[model samples]
Target: MMKVFDEYRALSDDTLKPDQPKAKRFIEAMRKFLDKKENWTFWLPYILTLELCVKCGTCGEACPVYTASGRKEIYHPVYRSEMLRRIWKRYFTLSGKIFRGLAGAKDVTEDDINALAEAVWRCTVCRRCAMVCPLAIDNGLITREIRKIFDAIGIAPDELKENGTRAQIQYGNATKTPTEAFKDTLEFIKEDIEDMKGVSVEIPVDKKGVDYLVINNAGDYIAFMETVMGIVEIMNYVNADWTLNTPDTGVNDVVNYGLFYSDAELVAVAKAQLETIRKLKPKVVVIGECGHAYDSFILYKKLYKEMYGEEMPFKLTHIVALIDRWIREGKLKVDKNKNPEPVTFHDSCKWGRCAGVYEEPRRVLKAVCKDFREMYPNREMNYCCGGGSGFAIMFKDEFLKFRMETYGRIKAEQIKATGASVVATMCANCKGQFREIIKYFNLPVRYAGVSELVANALVYK
Candidate 1:
């Protein structure tokens, strides 16, 4: 049950020797990052995460990665975090310098860095581990910081970098959808929504001074057009003053894969998105169907307030929370019988754990799902979809196999146990993860978005 990542296996025999230029560069970057006090602000959570760990294995029991690995020692939540602690102590702490070997501080090396780098990317940053820890130590946050260090040395998962981070910085969206194509996609979605739902709705684009600038995961428009339609249908039904900004992450696609790779990248992508909102001067920014993007916005909004001396001119809210509000307000009459199948909700780590959005999606689900069954350990304590970070998109042979058989297996079993034919998820990644697991495990389950369920349950007057 050991989950072996071939990429890590390939990286283990590292060529970045102590005397090599690459090693020197990597070490320099590591030292600069470790030595800086300003970065302490960025890494305070990681510092708290590393310092607070008591080597208690309680979190390991809760970690899907650790559990799926047959409780492999390397995959334990403590493994990489403890490694970071030792490295930090060795390089940065006085006790480490005075006591050295007695303090368990060892000299940092290329091999040590390589090992930690390899191990960190294997995690999903689901933060479920943190919930179970007595000290509330977050191994997921530690892993993400380690990935940023690895990324500083130009070591990172390519799927997230070339396709995700780089694309977001360059095009304002990770999918690399051109500005014109984005506009066209919106127009197409409006038409498609009208045709499919018999709801002729105007999809606003770049219209300034709206109360809300609603943005969704651009991936939905590209891969799941119906999700876009569902979101628009809800907006039109509510007669909300909203506009879809399709041009960039600044105004449009509200996803930031940089959260998985680098803090700098996360900030850059957020600034672009924030600048777009500022230009539009919307009252509230509603993130649609993408949990992590909302997570990024929540984190970055605070950071922006710190850096810019004032919060942006907009309030931030997730569509799920907004939908729940609408349901409670009787703004949309829902017919739960429209979804006749037994359904269960899967909590996106970002929405439920990271963002504390526990009840909104379920409340929305309950509004539309007749036979909604609760998955064991649902909400804040829920298991990851095995693709929380970005694994669902890594389709390479060995990585894909590890993803499905190792990370995704437990989730697939969880759904199978639910006896629910439809599994509802808010995050696009969660949906993709479940879809993959259903295929791999041959389970009788299909994925549905909360918006999709809402759209289905809409009482068409």
Candidate 2:
């Protein structure tokens, strides 16, 4: 029995034992998830991980959840990966059929399936384990594969499945904001910009033939409009032609929750966004400060090929890269003295590690802030914000407590060590996680998107 870490609430399904019929369905689902080629992008790599992982336990040392939970065995990356590996060997491998116990294989049961579902969610799928594994096995891939199986069997969190991917696919945004309401929100942001800076800027929406079509996570309009304003400010200052897609275009939001779970849903959302992009005909599609959105756009080229049997029609890039270019090209004037507070950058896992966007945001920060500090083990090695893989939006009270008190503790300590008054990160999820961490840990620090700081430091000359 894997012990639950002290004080953290066990997941609701931790003790569940599915009835016979449900158990049969789960076993069938797992088998299909394992064998389906459509379900995976890197099928050979996954097989390599399943067959080659040596159980060295080096991955656990690099896992933030394991380290933050005081090295809880349950939260270890290999602990979760081992469960899936054992199940795979039990059902699919030749030697396991003959030498079950000796081969470390066991009979699949409702109890086992339930436990597997519970184990997969406990991880944030940051892929830090892959970074440390000597064999370069991606434990995050296993976790996501299990999640894909669970989602097929209707065993996923509603926050991610129902409100996240489902809502995004059906409603053009996860929030399900009406088209008119989205327009009203943009108008409100425009008014706020005028009020703050005494400038009247017309935000281009649904405009055709623009050089850039910028898509942010729809949630930013609700929770982080200031960050949206920041991007808009810089775009205007640089005289760059850009437009935000209206909901009518069916690609209003940058969020793609499928990146966290089902490849089917991932492709579904990507296809919808691609159709919209095809219609818009923008020179570039800019993903705003959401890590998964950045990750999703990165997959567009391959996904587009898989779907259309043709090349991706539009170019995609993250907003931070554009900000860095603008600053370096002298397109936007910035006064670093405008931001005097001690600031530190929290490298989001997908944006920095997975996307290989390490130096761009750091360079942008240095150009905009006078007292920028670096977190130890920064860039690709930086710890997760306890909010990757769509956990930031999940809000079960017990899980939230675990997210902050246990999973987020190590990141909180990292932030404290920087001694910065403001934490600058490019991912919205990281900012959301920091919101909880600041309150739970009672650290005297606030968080902002890097674009928000750049907007603050912009000098209109």
Q: Which one wins on TM-score?
A: 2
Tens-place lDDT digits, model 1, residues 1-461: 12233243322223222223344455566666664474654557766775666686888888887788787788888877877778777767799988987886877666566566667767888888888888877888888877777778877767787778778767767788888888888788788877877888988888788987888887888776667778889999999999888664354678888887787778877787878887888888888898889889888768788667896678889888889999999998899999989999998888888888888888898889999999977888888887778776766536666677666888888888899999988898887787778888888778888898998899977
Count residue pairs with overlapping backbones in model 2.
0
Please write out the lDDT profile of model 2 over residues 363-417, one tens digit for every residue. Answer: 9999999999999888888888888887888775477887886668888888999
RMSD (CA, angstroms), candidate 1: 3.0
Model 2 Cα displacement at 245 (Å)?
Answer: 1.2
Question: Once superposed on the true structure, which residue ranges of model 2 sit more than 4 Å away at CA?
Answer: 1-21
Location of the lowest summed lDDT over 10 successive residues in candidate 1: 10-19
Evaluated at residue 455, the lDDT of candidate 1 is 89
- Predicted model with the maximum lDDT: 2
Which lDDT values do the candidates have, in the order given?
Answer: 0.78, 0.83
Question: Model 1 — TM-score against the truth?
Answer: 0.92
